[model samples]
Structure formats: structure tokens, C-alpha cells
Target: MKLASLKTVSNAHNDSIWAVTWAPATEARGALLVTGSLDESVKLWRGDELEQDGVHTGHSLGVIAVAAHPSGNIAASTSLDSFVRIFDVNSNATLAVLETAPSEAWLMQFDLKGSTLAVAGGGSASVKLWNTSAWRLDASLSVLKSDASVKGSEKTAGKFVLAVAWSVDGKLLACSTMDGTVGVFDVSRGKLLHLLEGHNMPVRSLVFSPVDPRVLFTASDDKHVRMYDAKNNSLICAMSGHGSWVLSVDASPEGSALATGSSDRTVRLWDLSMRASVQTVTDHTDQVWGVAFRPPGGEGVRAGRLATISDDKSINLYDYS
Candidate 1:
């Protein structure tokens, strides 16, 4: 597979764009792309044209993570202030405002069914799960306990959960921590199954394969991306080419390709069959923070699309073929 540049929007955000996700198609609209930034706002953009749909702001600090519900009608964003905002995608109306303890809401994602939301609880060393319908705390999957003195300090080398992902079946939950440990949990039983440890630095991003519930991928400050078998508790392979930290990763809908962004100021497309980067896009002048593939399902949506955001305050759109 190859990526052909479709559009580039300079200064797409006033500050570093930290998160990007695709909202599925609704009855009234086609699929939309949403991004969160250090500018403390979440901006929505129309598909391949890269046209701005709207911007919503209320967070006190930089928005670190944003996730669109599977239904596409709702979305959630979390900030450095440990606040999670659930809002309407089309109307831009605030639906819920959830405040986690300082440093708890580092990353978040909605389950495949949109019935539950899981957050990587930063200093808390747990995955915070929320019930979407009632907007209430549902479950907390604790990975490790922090040292008493370093409970909430960002500078501490504790088990700070930095990323979270759920399997397509919604049966497994994985959370990666600042210390580079990935914890796998059984969602149905609320139990910690085991910890996958290969990375020593922070594992900042993770995603489950869209095609396989047992295959998991992770990106870390170690400047490498690792693939693992979540069910068997083993590492499958590790790919390294980025000059700097591998910051984010997202699998394609077809499951044959993976896209990643890094602190090296480049976006890479990995071929799953070869287990190597097939294309590297150096369009951003600064670190690339987020990359997302447009979810399958809208009207007249046959072509594949990938979107990326960077610290250079820009957004890049590409056609995956």
C-alpha cells in the first residue's frame, strides 16, 4: 500500500495537536475527522477536503486525547487538567463533564459498541471505565500501585497509565504505562490478566488490530513499535526505524496496514505482511502527534483515508491505496 498526499492544512491548530480520531457516518452527514490540541480545543473537519467543521473549547489545559463514539453522534476529549468532556458531534453541545483527579485522565477511548468508555488513569495506575448512557464511573482496572510519596507527581517514574485500547469484541482491555508496561485485563471479570513488558521507556500509544482481537500494537518513547499477542502474553515482533520517539499508531480498517506518527517529524505507513515501514511522509516540520484512518461505513466511502496532526500546527490528509 502507498499513501498519496491529498491535502495539507497549515496552522490547523493554534498549538500542538495531540489526538485525532474519525467519527463514523451518521444519517445526516458523511464521516468526519476530529482532533484535539494543546490549544485546549477540539476541532472537527470534513473528510478528504480538510475543511473545518467546528471548534469547541472549555478545557482548562491542553486537550490530550479525543475519541468519537462508535455511533458518531457523541465524542469525548480529556485534558491535562484531568477533565473529560463528552459532547454532541453535530451540534457541538456539551453532554457530560467528568473530572478525574489531577493527572488521571491521560488517554481515553470508547468501546467498539459505544456502550462503555475507558480512560488511562495517569497517576492512578488504572484504566477508568465509564458507562456512556448514564455518564457514570463504571470500573477501574488498577495495573500497579504508585509509591506513596509520588502519587500524583508528573515527574515521578511511577506506573502512570498513558494509553488505553479495547479489543473489537470489547472483551479485553489494555493499558500502557509511563514505565513501559502494558497491562491486559479481562473486561468481563474485571481482572488483571498479566503485564506485557518489553519497553523500558513510556509507552505512549496503543491500538488493537481491527481484524484480530488478539493482536495488539504499541508505540513508545523507546523509538520502537512492538506487536504482541495479547492472549498468549508474548511479543510477536518489534519494528524500529524512527529517529525519535514513536508517539502514536492506528491500524487500517482492512487490517493489512498500520499508520504511525513520531517525534521524528514524520508519519509512517507499515505493511503488516512485511512487518516494515513501506512509506514515510515527512510533511510536518515538527513532531507528528496523531494519525487516524477513517472508519469504514459512510455513503460513497469506498476509498481509504488517513489523517495526521502534528506539533507544527498542521493537519495532513492522504489517500491510502
Candidate 2:
């Protein structure tokens, strides 16, 4: 896929736009993009222009997580206060406020079926699963360990989960934590399954391949994105070029390419097979916090689409081909 700048909404947010997700296009609204910022606001954009469609508020601290319910009718965002706000993507009305105290919050995600919500439980060293219908936390898959040095540590767990992803089948959930641990869990059984190892730094972003359940990609402060054999927890390839921390990552609908935003103030597009960056978007003047490849749908929207948000308080929409 190639890259083309579609639009740049300057001062899109007052502070860092730390998280983003694409709300699948609906018959009534078309596909929309949602983003959460450190300024404590969630903003929505309309059409291909990426104009401000609306804004949702109530977050008390930096909004570090945002996820669209698989159905695209509802979306959720989480902040440092450890609150998850589920709201109507169209009317912008609050649906439910989910809270898990005693545990910090980080990246969030909804199952492919839209029946469940999964959250990376930051300080709790676990991934919290919630029943979407009741909006109640159903099970907390704790990162139990027998690896002696970690199991009994009192350092408050640098294994603080920072990001998570669900396999395309919705059967597997992988969580990346501050301690550089990638825990692949079996959600149906609420059990810890396997741990993927490679990076020694905090893993900030994770995404399961849309086409391959056996494959997963992760970005970290180590300035590398490694493709992994999820089932076996084996490293497949390492893609590195970012000069600073890679903050967010997502794949296109076709699964042939992926996008990453980094603290180096650039958004990069990578060819999965080549394990190399094909394009570097240097438009953002500050650290790029998030990047997403819009899902393929609707009647005739061709060309790949990539959306990026930055600490510079801007949102950039790029045409990918």
C-alpha cells in the first residue's frame, strides 16, 4: 500500500491523542474514526475529510485507551482514573461506565463478536473480561506465574498490562505489559495459556493478524515490531526502524500491511512479508501516538486508509494504496 495525505486537522485535541479506533461504516453514518486524548476528551470524525463530527467527555485523566464495539454502534474509552466509558457512537450518549478499582487501566478491546470487552489491567497484572450485554466484569485472567523471580516479586509488578489484542476468532486474547511480558490467554476458560518472549522493553501495542490466527505483531519501546507465532510464542521476524518508542499499531483489512505511530514523530507503513517499512509519514510535528488502517467495507471506497493522531494535538488522515 502507498501513502497519501488526505487531511490534517490541527489542534484536534488539546493534548496528546493517545489512542484511536475506526468505527465501522454504517448505512446511516458511514465509517467514522474515534480518538481519545490526554486532554480527557474523545473526538469523532466524519467522512473522508476527517472533520470534527462530535466530541465525548467525562474522562478525568489522560485517555489512554479506545475501542469500538465490533458492531460499531457503541465504543468505549478508558483513562488513567481506571474508568471505562461505553457510549453511543452516533448520539454520543453514555451507555455504561465500567470501573475496576485497585487496578490501573491501559489499552482496551472488544471481542470480534461484540459480546465481550477485554481490558489490560495495568497494575493488577491481569486482563479483565467484561460481558458486553450486562457491562459487568465477568472474569479476570490473572497473570499467574511460577517463574520464581516474577511470581513473588514485590516491585508492584512492572508486568503491568499496557496493551491487548484478541485473535480474529475471538477465542484468544494476548496482553502486553510494562514488564515486557506478552501473555496469550485462553478467554473461554479464563486461563493463562502462554507467554511470548523477545523484547526486553515495555510492549505498548499489539494486534493479531486479521488473516492469520497464528500470527501476531507487537510494538515496543525497544523500537521494534516483531511478528510472532502466537500459538508457539516464537519470533517470526523483527521490523525495526523507528528512532523512538513505537506507541500504536494496526493492520489493514487485507492484512498485507500494517501501520505504526511512534514517539519519533512519524507514522510508518510496513510490508508484513518483507518485514520492512515501505513508507515513513513525517507530517506530525510531535510524537505520533496512534495509527490505524481503516477496515474495508461499504460500496466503493477503494484505496487503503490510515489514520494517525499525535501529541502535537493533530489528527492526520492518509490515503493508502
Per-residue error for 241 in candidate 2, Å, reads: 0.9
Candidate whose lDDT is highest: 1
lDDT tens digits by residue: candidate 1, 1-321:
999999999988899899999889998899989999999999999978889999989998999999999999999999988899999999999999998999889888999999999999988878999999999998998886444665455533568899999998899999999889899999999998989989989999999999899999999999999999998899999998999999999999989999999999999999999999999999999998899999988888899999999999999999999
Q: Cα RMSD for candidate 2?
A: 1.6
The residue-by-residue lDDT of candidate 2 on 78-158, one tens digit each, is 998879999999999999998778456788889899998888888888888889999988888877565656445564457
Regions of model 1 farther than 4 Å from truth: 145-157
State residue 131's C-alpha deviation in candidate 1, in Å.
0.4
